[model samples]
Target: MARVLIAPADTRLSNLRYGKSYNVLNNMTADDVTIDALVGEEETAVEAQNVHVRELGTQNRLQYYGRSFRTAAREIRAGSVDIYHHMNLSYRWFNPVLLAGIAADTPTVLGPCQTGHAIMAEEFNNMLSQAVGYELPLPVSNAVYYPMNAVRDVTIDPVRMSLFRRTLEAADRITVVHEEAREAYARHVDESKIDVIPLGVDAELFEFTERQDTQTLVAIGRLEQRKGYDVLLDALANVVEAFPNVHLDVFGEGPEEQALREQAASLGVADNVTFHGYVDQSVVRDHLARARAFVHPSRSESFSLVRLEAMAVGCPVVVTETAGAHEMVRDGKEGFVVPTEAAEPIADALLELLSDFELTRAMGARARERVERNYDWRAIGQQYVDLYRSLL
Candidate 1:
């Protein structure tokens, strides 16, 4: 049996960020594999049927994940484990500092991760401008925060790039969540060393349900700039003009909640939309199970697990080109893929779905079938097992 050390970014499965990582961690069970996983638990080790889990951190705080990687680098039983699999993201401040010192040295895997594609200055400004409308109050506008993030992004780039470059140098194999992420990393690492293994879904957990053909569109994501709740609201306003009874349900909450609510009211779609702040996954799955369509109008995103969940629940998705989730859909077959940050295109796609319920039902069935065939966690875990064997 080959021994493997898997370091997940988080194990609590509390927030949406770690959903994919947690699922992948639990499902990695093979007879020839002995899994040793570092979890988010401080004192208590959670039960996994096949994994021997331990804790290296008190909790999965924002700063803790980076610190956890730093901890993992410093402590490892050299040559005891066959492969060192850094199952979370690798591009961080101190993540690659001593990354190559793990068990078995050269046989290491990093990521199934992503460093989001660059956002141009012009694009950032335009997205914020659209999200923050004409009535710009000092407190209401998110414009001020953008400059801070821009400076942070600028300052962090060289450090992260240098660290990531070191990570590429040390990693024997690297995995990315999507093809775009693979392409982005290929500029720095050898393309042959990189693998595109997307985050998979459990079709059983998110079972297929027939769309009830209501004039309802659902979107699940944090109410933040990256998730593009602003663009969705703009499209909802237009969608309401055509189908006055159309409704939108948004899940998750963030710093942008107030700004988003104000934007919805400004667009005159407040009455048509409900902001359900930070609901459990079951609630999100329930909404996706019945909605006519799922629209994700993100300005910039590398991957979207929510889109996968929506698809698995038998709802077609209307995602923007910037989202990696668009790749999962065969345009017009599963759902329409629209341009990023454009309300008209999003609205147009929704209108088509609403116009023909039969199209949504067909698309929903296709979406579920595609997920079962291509994105099942059972099959995805097997891919990782294959990679581990290849390393050995």
Candidate 2:
């Protein structure tokens, strides 16, 4: 049996959408592999067995790449684990996991790392400018909107790049969620070492329920500018013109809640939109089961687990073309993929689905079937098992 150590930036398992390290640990239950977790002190709870929660002390930020690497290396050296599997190493701060693997002489698998940092930064700025009704010059805009990147370039990026190169050189295998992420990481490492492994959905939990005969559209995600809720709201405003009864239910909370509410009012769709604010997963599943369609207009996404969850629940999805998860859904089969940051195309897609119940139902069924065949956790877990065995 291969005893593997899993290390994630966070272990609380709360970030269900993007932070999938917990999901990997929970699902990889092959008889031939035993798993343990090394998590940061920030994690509130850990359900996995043999979890070692380390206090990262004061230097816990991503900019402190060396500190994080040293801390993880110390823990890895002390453990009897054979293989090291680290999630989300693209954050630049978590480059230490690669060093820890080398220090311990353990075969390492890094990533499912996904980021189009520059693209995301630009989109974020665009959304912010649209929200505030002003645009800054490109250079000034980037510096102002994405101060974190500047900070990273100054403190973390230099060290991170050097360490990342070393880590990629040493890693036995690298996994990415989609081609976009694979392309981004390929600049650093041998493309042959990379494998694309899409994230899985818990099909049983998000089991398909017969759709209710209502015009309610659902969107689930943190209320962030990148989520493009403002764009969705704009689209919904147009959608309501075609189907006046059309309603939108937004699940999740963030700093942009007030701004989104204001946007809904400005668009005159306030009455048609409901802000469900930070609902539990069970509630999210319930919404997916009953809603007419699931719409995500994210400016960028590495992988969309929520989109899969919606698909698993027999709900057709409307996603952005740039979303890495769009790769899982065939346009016009499971759902429609509209151009990013556009409301007209999004509204058009929603109107089409709402107008034809039979078409929507057929798409929903196909979406569920797709999830069963390709995105189930059990099957995804086996892929990890195979990867681990290859390294051994």
lDDT: which candidate is best? 2
Question: Model 1, 1-392: lDDT tens per residue?
Answer: 88787765453543243366666766676788887777666233334466677666455344445565665655454346577777766444334434444543547888787766445443454435444433344443346655657687678677778877777767788888877788788888799999988888878989999989799888877666777788888888888988999999888776688998899888888999898998777888888887999988777776777778888989999998874655688899889998886889999999999999999999999999989988887778778888998998
Over 189-294, each residue of candidate 2 has an lDDT whose tens digit, in order, gives 8999999887888788788877667799999888877789989998998988888988899998876899999988898999999999987788888888889999
lDDT of each: 0.75, 0.76
Give lDDT: candidate 2, residue 375.
Answer: 83
TM-score top scorer: 1
Q: What TM-score does candidate 1 get on C-alpha atoms?
A: 0.84
User: Which 10-residue window in model 1 sums to the lowest lDDT?
Assistant: 132-141
RMSD of 1: 5.7
